[model samples]
Target chain A: MPRISKSDVVNSTLAFITLILFWFLGFWLSHYIALPAALLGLLLLFMGLLCLGRVPKPLEYVSQFCLRHLSLFFIPPLVAAWFYAEQLGNNLWLFLFAIMFSTFISLYLTSWLGQRFFGHSNQSVSQDDES
Target chain B: MTKVNTVDWQSIIQLVSIEQLLWITITLFAYGLAIWIYKYFAHNILFHPIVVGAILIGCIGVVSATPLQDYLIFVRPINWMLGPVTVALAIPLYQQIRLIYAAGSKGLLVIIIGGCVAPLLAIGWLFLFDFSDPVKLSVLTKSITTPLAVDTTNIIGGIPELAAGVVVITGILGVMFSKIIFKLTRCDDSRAQGLALGTVSHAIGTARAHQIGAKTGAFSTMALCVNGILTAIVLPLVFMLFG
Candidate 1:
């Protein structure tokens, strides 16, 4: 295992503080605005952090770690899904069909539109799966 | 071997209950197992971790009669992490800003079209059936990712939980059928495909896009952020004016 440093801890702590601050902003703003507070906070914080002159190196590492395990956060919601499972009752097929069909249409239309209208002038044909 | 009759295994098991620790252990184990299965099957879309884990937990819940509330009690920590996890998306967004700017007006147009068309298609399809308003609303936000999808649905007076479920399902479908859609449309542009996947399917499609290439992943991330913002602003206003 690699040695953990104090700077890394500080950077991660600062990043978390930023997240909490934004989350609270979103939470408070929710009273007046219709948008989800945490999401709005996320957007605001992203812009702020992006525009900052001195971006912390540790922040990047911390954020990468969080994003890599994004699915872990989703597990709770999936579990919460059980509460509403009964809501599907008889329309489960309809629900599934609707989601599948709409997604298919959306993907088709969006991509087709991108290709048809925008062309590939800016797109590179080379594949770069370096990650 | 026949002398150990005094110990009651049932009492011990009941006394421990195991519900508190069960959530963390079972969920991680189930997700890990699901990923293993997915890999074992050569990353078959059918064996996606989310789907498999959900099924595994669902079965366990049904058989064991574990109340959803009990699960929620221990799962709260994971749920609480969502806010921070969402905030972390900003890092990718920041990194991809240059590419997004490079696309310029054309990219803006694509994002707008995708933002509107996704939910409109949902609304139109639901209308064809006899679905209730809440159901329609839930499906309306299916195109975006979870945090934004839940918010959009909530603003539109829809069921947020239902929207979250549908949003996840939409992502899985996007991952599974993207190739077919690309073939049918004859759109060989990987950038365009990434944009579509991210705009319509969100994270799952982004994961697929990354599999395709780095450029595709960047474009997909751009689309995910842009579409999320656009839908968050546009969907409710459209519903209000002409719903």
Candidate 2:
């Protein structure tokens, strides 16, 4: 096992607290606003705080690690979905076809427009790519 | 089923909460096995861990006669973690702010087009098929990430479960097929590829972008965030106007 440092532990704890705080904020706001909007609102607030406070190294590490492993977080809902799978029994084919078709169409159109208009001239775009 | 009801099983059940422990262990083991399978297969898009993990878990449920309600008792913690995980996305969005600015008006245009057309096309076609309102509403937010898609679906009076499932399906399709689409279009620009994937498929698309390059991942994150916010706000309003 890799050695765990005290600062790393502190950072992870702080990151956990930050996420919990935003989760509560989202819960509170979900009563008034849509849940997505409330969650997004909380995310933006977190971002603003990070900027104003100058993100700590530990927070950065925790967030990036969490984001990279984001799929793990989705496992619960995906599994819970088993409960409602039967609801989709009707028109399931239509749902599948429409979703797949529209997704491809959206992908094609967005990329085409992005390629034509964006052109990747900006230095930041190049810098990120190189990194 | 016989195995579960066997005399030997009765003794085991009396000794402990066999059903709860069995389901919990099965869920975790399924996820681990799925990841191993995904890695063994070289991360083939079709072998996506969630898809395989769900299948494996479902099989266990069927074979053992374990009810979904019973399984959920042990699985709900993983479900609740989604709230904090959703908030965790802020870190990436914050890091990618500079690139978001660099994409500029072009990024805005792609988002506007994707954000509007994705739902319109999905819902319009479903309307023609005469699907119920809830089904149409469920599929409308299919292109966004699951967290945002479920929430948006909830507010718009759509079925959250259906929305979540469709979102995952759309994401898998987007990741699996994007290679051919990108090749046919000769879309060499990483930003464009990332934006397209992020807009259509959300996190899975971003994961694919990461595989291709860092820049693609960065731009994809921007696209994911923008597309999510747009859909979350736009879908409900559109529904209100024409629902």
Candidate 3:
């Protein structure tokens, strides 16, 4: 099994604090624009990382933990959606049609595009790396 | 008839005020049960974590006569953390910058087309159904990951909850049908398969893609981050201009 790199308590806590601070920064920016605070936080952090030209070890370590358990976080929202279930149910066919049809189309289009445009080239590059 | 009438959903409203701890335990346990099921079964699509956990929790609520509002009081903290986690998504995105650059204009073009056109197609497909403007707007963000989709949906005057629900559906359905879609489209390349999964299905798609292979997972994650960030950036700006 591959080793899991665990950050110490201090680094993880510091990383959490940094993320909260960035979230606050993004929240503040949202008031001046028509966007979500978290997304602005994401964009700001993305730019910051681009400037640094590297992801900090602590941030990467901590974020992976958060992302791994991301599904658990969503359970409440889905359950709470019971209140709106009536509306969703009424439009169930429309919802399913749009969601399934569009998703299939996009997946099909993207896979075809990716294969047609970059398949051979990417394969060659990986082959070179292996050699 | 008297027993049935007296035991209806409304009666529970006055019967008891359940503690938050109980609900939290139930939520966590449901999630644990889902993990156990996956470990034993080696199946994913039919039993996606969110679907399983949420359904179990919802079932518990119904049996306990607890409304979703009360359940929310217990799990609101989890929902609130989504914001910080959204910020964390940038970490993986940052890690991918080099790979994306190395992959060049071709990768960029694929991500851009997949990300942009997929959501638009959803909205176009919505034209067949006569939803309100706000309902129609919600579909715009459904192709992205949930947090970004919810946030973007809110900013664009759509229902954030609806956006989130559809995002999950998109993820599950995208993975569920990917095999057939790829074959029909003649997209035999593994890398492209991963990219399509991540680009259209978001997180759930990435998880399924990872199950396929590590290289596929990497490309899927790459597509996920780029598509998520791109939609989050562009959708809001486009709505701002429209208004």
> What TM-score against the true chain A does chain A of each candidate get?
0.77, 0.74, 0.81
Candidate lDDT (C-alpha), each: 0.76, 0.77, 0.80
Residue B87 deviation, candidate 2, in Å?
Answer: 0.4
Docking class of 1: acceptable
Estimate, for each residue in A1-131, the C-alpha lDDT of model 3 and write its tens digit.
85544546778889988898899899999999777899889889988888988877878888998888788877886775556656766776876688888888888889889888766764543621100
- For the predicted complex of model 3, DockQ is 0.48
Q: How well is candidate 1 docked (DockQ)?
A: 0.45
Pairs in clash, predicted candidate 2: none
Is candidate 2 or 3 superior in lDDT? 3
Model 1: runs farther than 4 Å from truth?
A1-3, A82-85, A122-131, B1-18, B238-243
* Number of the candidate with higher TM-score, 1 or 3: 3
Window of ten residues with lowest summed lDDT in model 2 chain A: A122-131
Task: Tell me how far the alpha carbon of residue B205 in candidate 2 is from the true structure, in angstroms, after superposition.
Answer: 0.5
- What DockQ score does model 2 reach against the true complex? 0.50
Model 2 per-residue lDDT tens digits across residues B39-71: 999889899887888888878878988776777
The CAPRI-style docking tier of model 3 reads: acceptable
Top candidate by lDDT: 3
Task: List where candidate 3 sits over 4 angstroms from the true fold.
Answer: A1-7, A127-131, B1-18
Model 1: per-residue Cα lDDT over B1-243, one tens digit each: 577668888898775456656777888888888878878988777877777887887777778887877776766666666776676677777777776777677777887777777677777877887778887888777777787777678888898777777777888888888898888888777678778888887888888888787778888888998887777777777777887
